[model samples]
Structure formats: C-alpha cells, structure tokens
Target: MSTRREARVTAARAIRSHAEDVVRAALVALPPRERTRRGLAFHAYQRQVRTIMRADPVAFEVVETRMLAEGHRTSVIEVTLRGEVGVDAGDMLHVLWRNDLDRIAAADAVTAARFWTTPIPHRPSRWARVGASGLLESVVDLSASTDSDPARAERITPRFFTVAGVEASDVRLQVTHTAGMPPRAASFLARVRPGDVVEARVLPHPHRVAHDGPGLAVVTGSGAAGVFAALRAGASGIRLVWGLGDKQLAPWVQEELREHLRAGRLSSLRLALRPERVTDLLVDEPIEQMAWIYVSGHESMGAAVDAALRARLGESVLREMSDGLRCIVST
Candidate 1:
C-alpha cells in the first residue's frame, strides 16, 4: 500500500483503539445497579462505540494522546479530522459520558430515552471587528493584572486571525517590549505586513519573532537577544539603539551586525540611554500614520511613550494601559 494510505489506516486504528479503551473503562467504573438490564448507560456507551467504529476512518488522525490527570485508566486523544465528523464523534463521546453521570446523580432514574444533549459551546468570532475602521486597536496585557507570564499571555490570544476572513496583508502591527519582559503576543508577528514595525529591549532568552515578510525592526538593549530576535523576524531594515550604561555587544552579535550592515539590511545604529530618549525616538513619526501600536515593559517607559503619543495625536488616537508594567496600545 502507498505511504499516505498506510498512515491513514494507522490513524484510524489508533482512534478506534482509543475510543474503545475509554468506553470500556467508563463502563467498568459504573456500579452493578447502574449496569443492570433496565439501565441505559450500557446501551448508550455501546451505541456511541458503534457510531465511532462506523465513522469515516480515513478522515481522522490522532495528533496527541495523554492520560487523564484524574488517574483514570483511560486516555484522551486529540484528533484532527475533516468537516463535521470530528464534531459528531466528540459530542457522542463527551455528552454520552456526561449523560451517564447525570443519570447516576438524579433522584429519579434517568434513562437513555430521556437523555437530552446540548451542543458544545463555542467562543464567539470577533475577528470582523478587528481593523474595521482601517486601523487595529487592541491591548495585549502581560502584566500581573492580566497574565503575568508572557508565555501564558500568548496562549490566550488566537493563533490565527483568519476566522472572520481577514488576510495577513490586511493588517499592520507595531510591537515594543521593554524592561526585560519576555515578548508577549509575538505569535501575531508571523502575520505582520511589510511596513510593520517591531522593537524590543532586553530579551533574556531566545524567542521566535520571525516575520512572514520583510519589515522594519528596532532593538535597544545591551544584550544581543533583542537584535537576534529582530534578525530572525526577517526584518529588511534594522536599527539598533544602545540602552543605558556603557555596555559592549557580544563578539558574535557585533559580527552579525557588521554582516547585515554590509548587506544593507541593518540600516542605522545609535545610542539612547535614557527612557525619555527611547520614548522620543518611538514617537518621532506621526502616530496617526500607523495601524497599530503595542507597548510593553517598564511602567514608567510605557507611560512616557503613551504620554508622548497622546500629546502629539490628541483625542484622535485611542490608547489603553494595563496594570503592573503599563502596556499601551494606540490606534
């Protein structure tokens, strides 16, 4: 058989095996009275299993498998499948199990004949409202008040903004990270347009900031992490502004900068030790011209940038700041 066909067959088998294991364990866990002839639990589980077995086998692929933390002998498998088949299978498995629980907890005997299933609740799609007025206005807070950890903050944001038929080229993003905070909401960087801007200061660890297209990037820090992040993001034009104190770049960073400078991708390099200086540089351009602005890191620096932008653009600009390290986003 062909490799693709073999993979599909294997995936089908894995899904079937997983489904059977879960059903069998759940059935076994029920008390003797719950499994008696008059009970609907056994029949419901059997029907669900049969439905799973009759599903289009080639349509499903098991992507991840993990044991339940509840210490149940059964395992949960995350499946990637086409169309409504996956949804139907999930409803059967999850709702059938829940129905059995409801039957057990009820004062009156609840049978399968009376079991009512509810559709799974889905998150509302609000992507249409994004950039509706030819600009993007949103605040991604990674401070203690919202989500303290940048990694956790990334998880809360949608991985793709295409749900409402928005294309990558339709939006531009300007992101700035400061005060040693890990880059938050960097996933959106993957969709940033050519003219988008990215700026960072003191990235302690390597983070994926790579852009899908060439854009402008600015890095201000003594460490090389910020510069490396900008380079990885495929920035066609890069400007490095040195941070506070007399700091020297690592030998490798210096070498990389020189190479990019020779190639014309690294456009300008300078020094801006004070936060006020950085703020001045950030607001050098007209705020009304940009589509979106995301500022994060030190509260003082964020406030400074916010004040500068508001001062320049006045009420025409929309700005929001969160607690902890003030993060400002303007449109």
Candidate 2:
C-alpha cells in the first residue's frame, strides 16, 4: 500500500468526524436570534457528516450576495487527505463507499444519528427555516487527518473541542424547531447517540468574552466594514474575516492564534488561500443545505467565502455585509 493509504487508515481510525466538528462549531457562533432553543434544535444538523470534504471533487457552486461575506469567520484549509484507505476494503482508489459509511455510522453516525444525515446537501438556508432531511446517501466521509503522528491527532482534537465549545454557547431551543422537529430532537443533539468525544474546553473568542458575545466583527477594510455594518444592524450573525493564505496574515499572528487556540481564547481562525476551486478542500462536493451557518471569505485565495456560506445557508438567514462574506444572523 502507498504511504497515503497508510495515512488514511491511520487517520480514519481516530479523527473520524473532523468536518462535523467544524460545522457544529460554526453554528455556535450564529446570531443570538437564531440561537434560540427551537432554532438550535434543528440547526444542530449542521454538525454531522456535512462538513467532511467529499472524495470526488465537483465544479458547480452557489453564489452568496450577502454583505457579511468575509473569510475570517469561516475555516479555509489546504487539506491533503490520503487515498480512501480508511473508507473501505475495495482495492480501487475511490474512498466514499457505502460500507465505510455504515461502519463509521456504526461507530459515530449511528450512535449520533442526530448529527449525521444522508449524503444530500441542504438547500440554501432561510432566516426562519431550518428543515430536516433531504436525501439518504449510503456514501459517508469520515473527517480525519492523514497525519500518522499520534501527537498530531491529539493536537488537532483540541481544535475540534474548542470549536464544539463555540457550538454549545448561547444555543437555545426555539419553539419553531421544537414544534416542527421530531420528539427526540433534544435527546439526540444534547448528546448524540454516537459515542464520540467531540467536545473540548478551548479558549473563548475575544468578542465572546469581551463583548459578551456573540463576538465582535474584526473588520479590516471596506469589505470588513460592510460585514460589520450588517452585523451591527442585526441583519447578520456569527462570522469572521480571514487573512491571505501565503503572506496576508503575518507569521506572528499565526503563532499567536495557535497559542490562543490552545487557550480557547481565539474563537475562530482563517487562511486566505487562492484555491483552484470554489468549495473548500476539506469538502470534496459542492456545498449545500448548510444555510444555517453564516460566514464570509476571500475571493482571490479561493471561491467567494460568502458564496459557500450562502449556498450552505440559504439567503433568508444570510445578511449581506460591506465586506466580502455573508453573516449568519438567525437560525
């Protein structure tokens, strides 16, 4: 077997739901209006297999016209997942097999079905709507790192936990979701059946602590200011502004972020990479049904961050910002 497969097998065993952790964390930072009890009841679905980058890459994408489309609030990465070693037994290289889904679901998804969903992506989200299942996909992607070092997995777990903390904060059960969702909603999200240790204690976002969050919008230029404008007006919700992938963000800033991440102080992080494609490298398929999350990202480094956020999160829930990202103001 190649080293990539070796890495995949190694990563699949440990970090099975890396993307889910990110999605769930992103929800935590949404606007307070949307964080209500019922709002969160349905919104928690974002936490499951949704964020995992798909094995097969696609070219089609949705557009995000919201004002808060800054890259800071969202997570952008150049993840190089190894061959589908961890996915299934088939010798052929494609990894997104159904057997792998059944197995991981058995371990994580089945237990935590609340978080996991069929492969179909949700349509763009509306401000007032958080719908349920769209389709049933046998194929499942386990969010894991290709790194072989145990310490790397260990180090990354903290990132997952920190983001999970962001998910847990201020989330209330909205009557809309409660009335519309099935009876088992709370039971599932409170502690999904899957026995995954998805949560950790990371530092709080500076805005979460200082401003009594939802955190502050650290807007940079006109784009950022636009995002700040929408957010201040209550049209937008949780989001961030990202830095350049190569040189935009200084090295010192990256080091400080690492330290803060360890301390759980840095609520979010960003990297402005000039991606060849629109969707994030972490996710293989085009974004969908994740409209509940509101974020903004860079255009040059990658596809429009707001576009991805808007595609996942429908326009209704999105608030346009002066900056280039969309804001998640409500559930």
Candidate 3:
C-alpha cells in the first residue's frame, strides 16, 4: 500500500503528465466533432494549466481515499487532501479542468480533499493593508474604514467578530503565518517595513466569549487575539495551547501571553511546535475535571478539544461560550 505522501505524488504527477487528456475528458459537453475542430484549443488550454501548475505546483497529501462508485473501466474516486490550503480539491481541479461541469462534478470537490499529485501548497488570497500592533502577531485590518484605503484596492474584506456597539478601532487581530498560508500573504507580511501596507485579512471567527460566564477559555492555534481580549475583559482562567509552527512572528505574541501568565490571568500555557498535536498536549491534563470550558481554534483541533473536554468534565459542567472555530481552509 502506498503511503499518504506517495499517493499524493502519484496523483499530482498523473494529473500533470496527462493534463491534456484529462482536460479533454473533462470537457464532457464537447461533441466528438469539436475535438477535431479544437486541436489548437487543447494546446492553448494545456499551456494555461502548465503555467498555473508551474507557479502553484500541485501537491497534496492524501488523508483518505475510497471508491465511491465504480465504472467498469474507471472507478469513481473520492479523496480528501491533507493539511490546509484555501483551495479545495474541486477548485484546484476546476482551474486545470477549466469549465467542464461534468468533470468538476465527478471530482467530488472538497477544500482539503486528497490528491494524486504533489498538492500545490499555494492558495489564493486577497490583499489588505497591514496594521502594526507592535507585537508578535501582524494585524490585517478588514474593517470598512481600512478597506477603502488606497493601499487596499479590490481586496475582499474578511468577516470578523464584534459586539454590537464595538467600533473598528476596538478590534485587534493576531495573524499567524501557518504552513497553509499563501506565499503572497507570507511574503507581504515578511518583507513589510514599519507602516508599510500589505495584503491580508482577518479570518472569520464566529465564536466570542459569552457576556456572562464562569467558564475558562481553552484557546489553541490562531485564535489568540480574541482570547486575550476576553482575558483582559476579566474572563478568568485561560488555558492557551499555543501551537507555533515554524518561525515565530514579530513582536512576539508569546511575550504578552507570558506576561498575562505571570500576572495570573492565564491558568496555564502549553507550547507545541510543528508536527506536535495540541490535543496531545491537552490529553493528560485534568481538563474534564474542570467544570466550565470555552474552547477556540481551527475546526479540526477545536473538535478534538471539544471531545476531550466533554469526556473529562461531562456535559453537565460544560457551559456554552462563543464558538471560535475558524471556517476557512488553512493549517
């Protein structure tokens, strides 16, 4: 049996090597006569796919693959991509497959679906002005006020969380450059000089800390800013599972978090490097023993945490707070 990495390489190579045929096959609507008439058209389309692949480099790790339906010659393959990228399997294939409705449908699109090729790591993202917070994390201001700035042209503003009366200035973000982050987004952030504008946005985090609650926050991954605010707003007993993948961002978000920890604002802080699971860090802890918990992180991690918490504390002690689970596809 091929490993996940091997399967990904195989998929990517197969797609790239036979791109022309795949595109042709994808154009299910094309009549047999049109294939003869469109000899040059396929070549042109092939060139476009080659160009996009060269820039993006299609690669993916297969989380799981199964046969959904079988045709005698070709089985209906279902795959889920590993890691995080904004682009889903369908969208990625769509770009290469062009506008073949039947082809797209057959692919069984998913944001993080498995792939046959080396999954392209780059995902598309919009530009936004960089706001300096003089801290470890960079801020991508997406408020209406910042969106209209000349620096931000034709960029999509991300939906962010806020209380009904809260203004833009009151919103603070801690943008972490995860492995799944787009190259453009990372480059703009990396080379950004003080006061320089860059392309970015705050991902939509629907969960907010409840107005009145006795629960403590269990924040992992990129949901730091919101939890920090909740702590400042007098939400007590924070358990921060800081998952720092690769290099640390400036002004050092940990410094502020550490300060809070020292001040007793945080109940605990566990740091995990890349390839380390946040769930592992939390597993042995007496979290279930705690009566109330408010959790936040990327969806996958959040779900794991929720399950852990539920098993430990049981349903009775668990009070509902804000759902800080991130919706976008990312690492």
Cα miss at 161, model 1 (Å)?
24
Q: Comparing 1 and 2 by TM-score, which wins?
A: 1
Cα lDDT computed for each candidate against the true fold: 0.30, 0.27, 0.37
lDDT per residue (tens digit) for residues 270-295 in model 2: 43355423234324322332222333
The model with the greater lDDT, 1 or 2, is 1
Model 3: lowest-lDDT 10 consecutive positions: 88-97
TM-score of 2: 0.23
What tens-digit string does per-residue lDDT give for candidate 3 at 1-331?
0011111133344455456445544553353333332343444444444444345323333333333222222222223333233321102122111111222233322232222222321222222223222100212112112222223212221222221111222222233333333322212222223332222212222234432333345544344445555655555566656554433433344466667678666778776655787667877665544434555556777777767766765555443311122111112
* lDDT tens digits, residue span 225-303, model 1: 3334344334445444433323333455457668867866555555454333666565454345433333322345546
Error of 1 at 235 (Å): 2.1
lDDT value, candidate 2, whole model: 0.27
Top TM-score hit: 3
Top-down lDDT ranking: 3, 1, 2
Considering summed lDDT, which 10 consecutive residues are worst modelled in model 1? 1-10
Better model by TM-score, 1 or 3?
3
- The regions of model 1 sitting more than 4 angstroms off are 1-227, 240-242, 274-276, 280-296, 314-331
Q: Estimate each model's TM-score.
A: 0.29, 0.23, 0.39
Which is the winner by TM-score between candidate 2 and candidate 3?
3
